[model samples]
Target chain A: MTFGETLAEAWGPLREDAIQTDAYLEMLLAGATAGAAPTGDLPTVEGTALIDPALVGAARALRDALVRIHPSFRFEERLAGRLRAAVDGVALPRAAGDPIPFRSRPTDAAPGPIPGDVVAVGRLSVLAPSLPEPLDRLPRPVLIGGAIASGVSLAGVALVAWRRRPGRH
Target chain B: MPVFGRMRRGAPADRIAVYDTDRAAVRAAGRDPRQFEALYRKYLPQVYSFAFYELGNHHDAEDVTERTFLSALAALPRFEERGDGPSTFRVWLFRIARNAISNHRRSLARRREAPAELADALPAPLDPEHLAAERESVARAWAAVARLPADRRRALILRFVEEMSTAEIARVMERSEGAVRVLVHRALRTVARELGARREGDARQRR
Candidate 1:
């Protein structure tokens, strides 16, 4: 194989099946033996080297380019700080085994529901004091006055509806 | 099973254990936010590097990296370990980073803002004269990389920059292992050809 091809194969992802092969072993041994050689310089493998310095140089240059662009230390610190603040903002569940505090219920908790007669007063349902006597037993003057008031309101609504009816010119 | 057969079947036992540890770490982080710091510290450099290279600028890289981690933290509660190994978390994280980069790019496109040049994104060398001389060549190489199709470019970066295995890359990319191999091979060949052409042009100019 050409030197460029060899380098490419060597640099490429090592397939599991390829790792056990004689060729792979030989390549590994050659690489191990050739350790510390300059980037483009061909290592003296036991066999014919077929090394192309230019191809090796180009590959190294590409590798160098990929390595050159990285996050600065300041950027790392800034990002880490931001991440720490984010973690802190969350009310994370505490680590296990913390003791729970005891508390006592108040003797005067909210008052229970009121006990009284539920009387329908106009549109509202109100809980008020129970009447001492039935509706028929109420004072004659009070009953008569409420009846007159209800009649007046009903008459007023009827009069307005009649006045506003479509056919009434 | 024979050793060769075992090797061919799956990742080595030690590698699998490493991934198992990663999955455990991910689960811990999910359960407890405090545990997330370990994961963040371990992957910060890698994820940041991937972002910087992909976006070709520090500003966008930082933006995407921030969005990526925040999104990861928010979603960690739901991240299930599928026993696909440690690559599951790595792939999952990269997936977030990938989406963030895409959204950033889309927003930039909508605003009609051109991305910063790759050369500008690169840190200047300490030697001023050497940096001045090397700048064009580095820019040319990056420009060629930028010209590649998005998937191809990403595959190349994941393979070379992250130094990921084919299986790991396949997991991240959600592609078949064979397809990843072919994609990386094609990408490397393209880069080689581009560099070769540049060299010839430079030689001609010198003559």
Candidate 2:
């Protein structure tokens, strides 16, 4: 390897980062636009004028010079692998269809609003059935709690009746 | 303006003309999705390079670049016209990249893994003497950068590779311009010392 080769090799990883950046930007922009699709071409020098033209030109020159000087620059594959690993490490947003290992239990899932020990005590209002399913499904926690209270009340009434009976042996 | 105006045509070059035309189209699209895609086609490479250089690793860089454009598009509705609008836009995008890099490093640190070693992992060459010497310098520089106290490395990359102005860096790093300058100075000093040590080792080997 020559000095040029060394410089090129040093700059080698930078190119993959650039290409990935381009792809990502294209995806993000497409997502943003709703209908804008990629032409499947890498963004070219002509498109770079969105930045300062001089700087864009300089950057291109740098990349070209680095690549030419060190044509042996072979870090692209490894860089891509590491990039994938990093994304994995950070955890990308998973597809909704992806299997989740655990589902919440009814009681455990019933944390009353914003999570933690504050108990809400009042007449619970059930949202109208016409409301969206998510909204309709809510307040179930309060409803469950209501059932628990009603059962306790019935138990108390029976106990009182038994205590008051005069026929007790 | 006479001599210069005469030397160069009053009208801009074809590339500039294309850029101005494209920018107009993008601006016209305003809320239109196609217009933003045009903007992406026009500038994706530049944005990507800037993000990649700052973030060091491809994944985070790509994410940052993607998010920068997304945020820019989302905020386009409120993008006010200013005299230096294009320059401001570039700076804004880079600022996003800087923030992303910092956040990436922070999260990685929390996970207790080496922050996905930014330097290429390929074995350094040992063939030619000059190549070996230069590789040593480059490796030492990167190693020094990696070992820098967080604040200094941030300052160094922002100052040198990104070539951002002190004020711009101050905004991104959330430090006073004076503080950023100081941090950069210290970072350079550390890097210089490491490079010098490597050079000395090379000289000793040659003897």
Interface Cα RMSD for all candidates?
Answer: 14.2, 19.6
Query: How big is the positional error of residue B191 in model 2, measured in Å on the Cα after superposition?
Result: 1.1
Using Cα atoms, each model's DockQ against the true complex is 0.12, 0.01
- In model 2, pairs of residues that clash are A47-B42
- What class would a CAPRI assessor give candidate 1's docking? incorrect
The segments of candidate 1 whose C-alpha lies over 4 angstroms from its true place after superposition are A1-58, A72-74, A90-169, B1-18, B21-24, B84-86, B110-116, B127-136
Candidate 2 whole-model C-alpha lDDT, 0 to 1: 0.44
Tens-place lDDT per residue, model 2, A22-91, is: 3333333333245333223334443333433333322222221111011111222222222222222322
**lDDT per residue, candidate 1, B55-163, as tens digits?**
7777888889888987877666556556654466777788888889889888884432213466666667788887775766666667767767778788877865776
- The parts of candidate 2 lying over 4 Å away from their true place are A1-169, B1-31, B38-56, B80-87, B109-116, B121-130, B201-207
Which numbered prediction scores highest in lDDT against the true structure? 1
Query: lDDT score, residue A19, model 1?
Result: 24
